[model samples]
Target: MVLQMSSNQANPNTYMGSVVASNDVVIQVNDLHKCYQSYPKPIHRLWQSFMPKRRFYQEFWALKGIDLTVHKGETVGIVGKNGSGKSTLLQVIAGILQPTKGSFTTKGRISALLELGAGFNPEFTGMENARLNASIMGLTREEFHDKLPDIVEFCGLGDFLHRPVKTYSSGMYVRLAFAVAINMNPDILIVDEALAVGDVRFQRQCFRRIEQLKEQGVSILFVTHSTESVIKYCDRAIMLDDGELKLTGSPKEVVQAYLELMFGSEKDTDALVKVDVENYKVEFDPSIDNCPKQASYNSGEHRWGDSRAKICYYEIFQNGAASNGLMQRGDQLVIRMWSLFEQDVDNLIYGITVKTNDGNAIYGTNSRALEVETPAQRAGDLVVVEFRLKLNLLAGDYFISLGVAQDHDVKDNIAIDRRYDLIHVHIRETLDAFGIADLEGDLSITLED
Candidate 1:
């Protein structure tokens, strides 16, 4: 069932209502549904028009019973698989497409980046297109002229602004269009995967500008398939499945739900169990498996995947004993994790990554990289994995992320379980280091004389 509860009210797991009440609400959508009539041939459309009352075209609902609300300064990320009405919803909100049923409302001016060169004419120069696009977004002639300098500088188009848009590449076109849309001083910004066309640096610049707009109280509706960006920038996220709102909540939870839906098999019925390392019977060598701390069962500390397997506990050992959050530079460390299998997993890959506290990835390696062979695991089986990593890092706090997935690095490989920020390690500086890692530079500055 579709829940239409207000954002200001208690957001229960599921409920039903007609309106989302909020004093600061900038966008409200209630029981929104969009349908498109598809005809098999051109003659069918004409015949339907002549019949008047008879139906000839098939009805397709791209959006089904969508209820959402956004307030001032809120950035909502929309995600789903392809053909799930992401683009249709954005088009409806941008006034480019009208709903066949239900309704929606938007307060304040909205500038959208839905189509590439949407409001620009190919015959017109970049300068002319900028003026035309700004004017279409409700900017007056005086306002357009006043913002022209800023737009040109933001686009980094220099003298190319005088050239006709038909001669420009896709990146150049998006740059100009994005610059114009943002410099219009809009109260709401709607992006629909248009930023994916630009290069990395341009995308970064766009996101930075979006952050600035967010700070200035501009409501944003963003649609993208990138989960990392959704987690990093969105305050709230909603997932759509087959034209239905499947989940809506914090970014991490929503993204996790989406990932599980895409990769997970049938749900398992076994309850989670934590076994103490010292007490549990050893199936393997006790010397290699024993660690100081007890096994932890905190599933809340990380995001998980399908229930085929799970990481029950993890710890880091320095030298021979378990280390408690402290490690020195160049210390030999062993990272170990215990996995509990709920379903048969033929092949598995163990992966580890080290990142800065701010989530910048410093180093990453997988079992595949080391050519390590893992035995096939069966249901009810427990496996222990230990990785030897050099502590050749600069003095700073870092996080470790772990994951177990299918035995491949391609897109088809499914993650059996994954955890972010699963372990935190702090390193005390013993020598001068400037970057995230100490490259171990060799000083051989001998005198030429």
Candidate 2:
């Protein structure tokens, strides 16, 4: 029962299709609730005996009223802060835990690589553990026979494969476990942060394998704190807050929502280590912006073109993706618009702006630069504009605001879209190893003594 639905029509809000169907649902979770019992404090229990407050126990709802459907061959990601119940949901899906209120139906074989050493035996040798774990995963000898070579090669643990698992390092064990899971040929692959355990090269190798599976249309339900990876890898994502699914959309939207939560408390920190609060600012990259020569507008009937549409909300993401303040520099970010038009006018104009914390304009672009003219627009039309470009910014936070105009005059100038406050990114030396960034350049330097 793989959720398999092909798109016959494009969703108005997204470039991707909304092909959801009941028959196509490979995985379904309805009213899923997982709760944990919490005993009252000893003093509270004593006081309850004397004067109870109706109930004496407490319940922690790990998941509340969760309803999600995953179609076959779709790569979906789960994102949230710690304690947001992402791990709990994945556990129920993998049959590791039972939901108190509801259950999920999943089709086909599911191979889960969650916590490291979850299914391994420390007493057994690596080779023995592999076979033992494979059997636990419901893999037959014939299947393991076919996949053993791949597992060995992926792990690069030739000599150690037969050594006692108890003697292996944590890294070695993780490599072996991940290799076996990938070779299982699962219909559903649940990968937690298992890839993070191995070295950088190994991590990249695993990502490449996952990427290939994505090309082959394997259904993946991945959970990670890394928003950048989610945005880059997952076609869509859902954001969770306090055991509830809060938002579902493109990765950029979900990650931004998570960061705003982090910043709320982090704003008061006196630390300057990760982000220099005083130096933080956000804006569009001017290098990638094209000042328009003219503008377009939307009419009242929500026509394809005209002016007078006002934006209600929007978001910008780099590399066309993001994580909780973990985006990289020189990433290509996209801008999305969700607008509502009130009245029709002769002209309509829109622009995107990126600025620094000190109020310096890093970049700005609008329809005016396209050298186009539009007819008068009527009222009641809706508009959604999309812009994408490579962002060549130093790692830091910045803010963006949308610009609105009519007849070459500011009608509602500098309208507040969504704010990207202190979008955080880690500038690593390894970024030079991949992507198309100039990065000023990378080379192995040697001292000529």
Candidate 3:
């Protein structure tokens, strides 16, 4: 069902830059700017209003010239560091805050789970608050009545739902708040990072409910610091840096860009070099022809680092033969990365992580972890780092990521270059397994008389 609410916001014809909204767009923002007037003293706020020419307040732009569009039934993740205006943008879209310059339009019944218990009154009972929240979310009287029982049951509060909200614990607060928000059947769900307060079980339940909502064609804008949630749930992601849009793309790629913005130095992401490894020869295992023969490294995959060094190419070798994507259980595998040092560096460390398709880490290793000492590197030098390990994994899809960092005394752990999901491999099912890894343990069943 397509539920829409009339938008009284600014005209859709106005734009901040070149952003144009399409017919399927549910939220359209053009040249959106939100600023707060900060005063040095409480009296200055009054003085600035009357002084006109004399400015007594400092302007802090929470959002600056932001233009974006969110299509229907899309779950977009918003990520940024603290003070990056992630919450501010969400509030603006949720209609809690008005724009300072530009205008935005939002369609549908928007229910926002922003700050914890934002719409609830402390003195009100949980039932009263739930009713109030449902009304605010545009639920009809009969609709809320029909869904109230389900909401109460999902919250698992029993008689506590009749108690005042002030007496509730933080976990209970989240349960009631989330229950009301989801049961109201909003067309657009806006969630901030408030779910972290709930316990693990409740958090998982909330994720499942959100997934259900997405399947029902509800648009969701989720703001979180959890990169795993973005990669696992969101179809698209946007990174905001100091109130500016830094990147917008697929979840994995955007998460990679966000990590680079946080951990590595800012550099051109398009800078790349090709590896010429044709001269190197390795004995082939002709029987293993099903393995992927090449790594899918392209501009679609996020890459970033300082220009001091770069990873030219990375490849996986199956049983001494170069392969990319196919593998079997208990097979000997070698991961080789060719790196070129563009500038002199004292010491370099190589790291690799084997992860599930959803970004869960199965195994990870680094030069520092393996007790291997890296020699000093000079400019115009090429180095090949290889990791050989038995593929003791179950039948599933997995990814390998590569990173190179410079070790220093004062400022250690500087990334020279890093690439996420550098290669993909699928472990062919050979044994009946259920979990992550094949421990290769013997099973014995004996019953005592």
Candidate 4:
């Protein structure tokens, strides 16, 4: 693997450079490109080697003209669909693979947990692999010993550490790997999807460690399919499409764009234009006359969709009366949403989500999950949906997101109309609860003679 020199030493287009000049920039990638040779058959590989320049294979570019910079303490998330070159870019940055055309520079020691058991020797014991990996990361014997206790405690592999790595389960493999990588004290951490293999407890532990590392000014490049994790942990995010850098921005914006790329269709724009014109002519129905005013509505709510269907009116009720955006904890509540269809649609799905003030989803449900079969509807038809449930939420401000979408077999639902955080509801104080929800626990005591 060749590391390109500074901009002065090499072509500016392909220069990776060291972190010598920039104090804050930890990782910089400029016009990076990577390609692989694809042969039609196994025999073609041998033929290509024998024929040399005689073109027995085609070039498959895995990365193309990727330019990125990671500042100190910045956690940049990489999100894309499968085969989008996420892993390829990371491998190049980690110096595990040589770039075919372009270059990228890294300032400090990088500890990457790219693939499961990637650096491990199957014949070696877990402890031996850990020592070898630590050494490879530039840790001395003293340093490795110093961190050994911490790694052992974190991984919780116990006696299994003496066993060959090939005998470990997928979860066990990630645990030991993560423990070593994080304990290496590198200035940059590159984590792929390896964290997904661990149990929830271990995952939480790893994230907590990652948060600590971020606070310590370690730049991190995280790649995952979980959009929620990106929104929750990342400062900025980049989306890739077909080996190309597509969009880069705040986490929410990038994730939204990625989702739109995945699930949104060209019809969305046309439907939105049509709905905007018809919205002015439509009048509110009398049934929802008591709906709360604009004060209860979230002005910063994000709304998008094809607009084939529009949520016209929405109201929340407690004790059979219109709610004023306030309700007691554990109160039985009713949520009503009215949608107007602008075009004929079938296999409709109505969904709702309850989220914290900080945008963490507490609970969500949809008609499809409840197995409610919805019939096809014609244009100009009005659909009213009512959801009745107990608001067992803790005392805090919460937001409700509503959506109407059409079912699709290949991907997620096609959004007819989706309103995120449209309604703001405040849960009044009640019996002490610790977390997001009140599970309503009961206590019993047995006396022994």
Candidate 5:
């Protein structure tokens, strides 16, 4: 399912421009085209038999006239719905699938965690497959022997690493595949949602390893559906649709545009939603036009979206001071949400989550998380929700996300009001000091002498 949410938020229009403002090119993709010959229909197939086999051939272009470039050390993301030719592009990049026309170039050793069981033989034992998997990734028997222990440890497969490849669970298969790919020491690592194969713990492990690769200046091309992950990990992102590159920019902007296209038409979706987010401006007053200086906002970090809900209003307040995305350390951060109901909805809930600049959830609070609920509201009822919590974070960028739920907390309902108002905080907290909050810890020093 394409899980999407948009919330009422106060955000700036400057985000889309900030995405491509950088100058770098690590991966250059020229007029790349990959087309597969499709067979004709049954009647056409029979007719082609009477005529010639050539008559039944139809060209289905997967990658058509593509041009792009990746800067050195850039972590580029590839996002598109299923059957969007993402897999085909990666396969061509890995040289596993040949392009029908045009040419592309990569200046480094390549490693990929594409599809599971990509090179493994089902009949082979896990141990046998492990060796073969590493070899196919460009390692000799001796090098794999030296790195075997590390892969086993990272994968956490334990004895299962020695078991038959076919006997492993789907999760185990992914873990092994990831372990082998990362340990093979590739200069250009390509990951295609294979990281989602394992458990949360394993997923965390894979991300940490990806971090290591990035630090070492290894170029990465990741294809995933998780907008949050793309914003967190990718230096930049490229969005594709129908084998065509649509938007290229920072994760949030691309994700927002992609979501609007996937969920519905780019226009106002009041039918599927209730709150009219276009009229929802809460933090900065209408006079500011989303600027930080003129309004209560003191910082510039923020994100926004329409969680698919008719998100009406979202505001951030610190000690009664109105702000869009600025919060000081040791202050009480209060997020207020207001939405107009368009239906007799049951189990309607509002939630707010705070994340660091890199997209780490500092904390989250929802109406249902507190076991609170509002009586069923009418079509015109305006629902207001607020969350108050302590702001305790080291100085860095951060974002706020608002969500609307119909039944459960999951985005099963027509979550419309997913807004990403930019949140930039001047964290006055000192991190070297102990404790979760920025409050100075109790310390004592006594001279025995």
Candidate 6:
């Protein structure tokens, strides 16, 4: 496809600039833009070709004024809603698409696992396709043969590698593609939502390979809808919104902004009446401190919602006694939060979420999902909520998030009070476990002679 730029090169509205060069920089983008022309009908295209002076098509800019830089060994994540130019940007960087305006520079051999089956020939066998892809990535015949065993082992396609790629499943396609890309020893890797097609085990394996590549000083640009993956793997992240580069910061911060953009409403925070916490009266066990000063409370919690309700106090308990953030893996735990309402609200929902220290959500449930009835609350009403469950999770640092909202419907909910990462809990190890949760499998042995 041909790219066209606006006539005015020095327009004051444009972010016209160039990126500074550095030896450690693997990739640098400066004021990038990509535009596509749309014709109303096939006749319009013919007419446009004949009448060069007349405009018969409309222009749509898929990307505009994007600036980015990646240093060696850094993993940067791109996050956005659909049609946010994420794939377009990656395509431009991968040399599959040219920019309409602006410049970018890359220093090293690049390998990309972009759209599913992008570079594969369907008629070719999986093994043949692997060899072709490796050659395209600049590997010699001898070099590819040397790495063929590693590629085959990593993909685990086994006998399927000899079959035509057209017969491969989506998961198989991803496996073969990722295997070739990772084994190519690229200086820069660009992954665009390809791993989501793999099974859980393969995804874990791919991430491990990515970690190894990171240690070898490979710069990577990754794009996925999985915020948890971004937070867990990326050192930094950038958010794209409606073809514009919106925000760039830590992975957690960028994911938070992306989620807010997706779910946030324009409700006025000041319109909700504020509750006076000092005058709110509720009876609690005298031995436990429900205030924010409790040991389980996370001082750096992030909170946002309308001011109609407020979570005033919270506490954690184990075995009927208030406990700090530490607990055994199998212990039963209780989380309590007190919320004061300053206005009438109906169909209230109370929710809690358990997340890893890096913000990967482990478990979350709300009153609605549990079939618990919640009546309307009026001004000056105090509501206390308790969530109790066995800590079946593996030993790790975890955080608890709390929220209170008015369920308008299944799709729409009004957040009254929401606090993220409000409490920190550490699960102490007892028995050996491998994954996030212990399934408690029963063991049986069979003796054979």
How far out, in Å, is residue 214 in model 4? 1.8
> What are the per-residue Cα lDDT tens digits for candidate 3 across 380-442?
567789998898998988877888987656445777877767777898876567777889867
Please provide, for model 1 over 1-449, each residue's C-alpha lDDT reduced to its tens digit, 9 standing for 90 to 100: 00011121233111223334564877888788899999999999999989979999998999999988889999999999888898888887776787766777676677788767676788989998887776666678998889988998899989989999988888998898789888877777888888888999999999999999999998899999888788788999999988878888988788778877766544353653333346446444332313224332222346567657777667678887877768888888898888877667776788998877655577888887788998888766777899888888888888788888886344556778888667778898765667777788777667786
Q: Who wins the lDDT comparison?
A: 6
Q: Against the hidden true structure, what lDDT does model 2 obtain?
A: 0.62
**Quick one: ranking by TM-score, best first?**
4, 6, 1, 3, 5, 2
Measured with C-alpha atoms, the lDDT of residue 279 in candidate 5 is 59
Per-residue lDDT tens digits of candidate 4, residues 346-425?
99999999988876788899999999999887766777899887898888999998889989987768887888888898
Q: What is the C-alpha lDDT profile of model 6 across 397-426, one tens digit per residue?
A: 899999998786543677777888999889
Model 3 worst lDDT run, 10 consecutive residues:
1-10
**Model 6 worst lDDT run, 10 consecutive residues:** 1-10
Computed on alpha carbons, the lDDT of every model, listed in order, comes to 0.76, 0.62, 0.77, 0.82, 0.66, 0.83
lDDT score, candidate 2, position 45? 67
Clashes of 1: 0
Q: What is the TM-score of candidate 6?
A: 0.84
lDDT of 5 by residue, 1-449 (tens): 01011111122111112122233433456677888866756687677778884567787788877776776577988888888888889887676776777666554566677787776777776677777766555567898899988977887877776678788788888877777777776667888888786789889888998998999988899999888888889988888888888888887677667665555323353554333434544453322223334243324433333333345445678877875555566778876666666555666667777776556566777776688865776655566677887777656556666666555333343444554443445555454764334555578899998
Q: Per-prediction RMSD in angstroms?
A: 7.1, 16.3, 6.6, 4.9, 9.9, 6.1
> Whole-model lDDT for model 6 versus the true structure?
0.83
Local error of candidate 1 at residue 97 (angstroms): 0.9
Residue 7 local lDDT, model 1: 21
Error of 3 at 145 (Å): 3.5
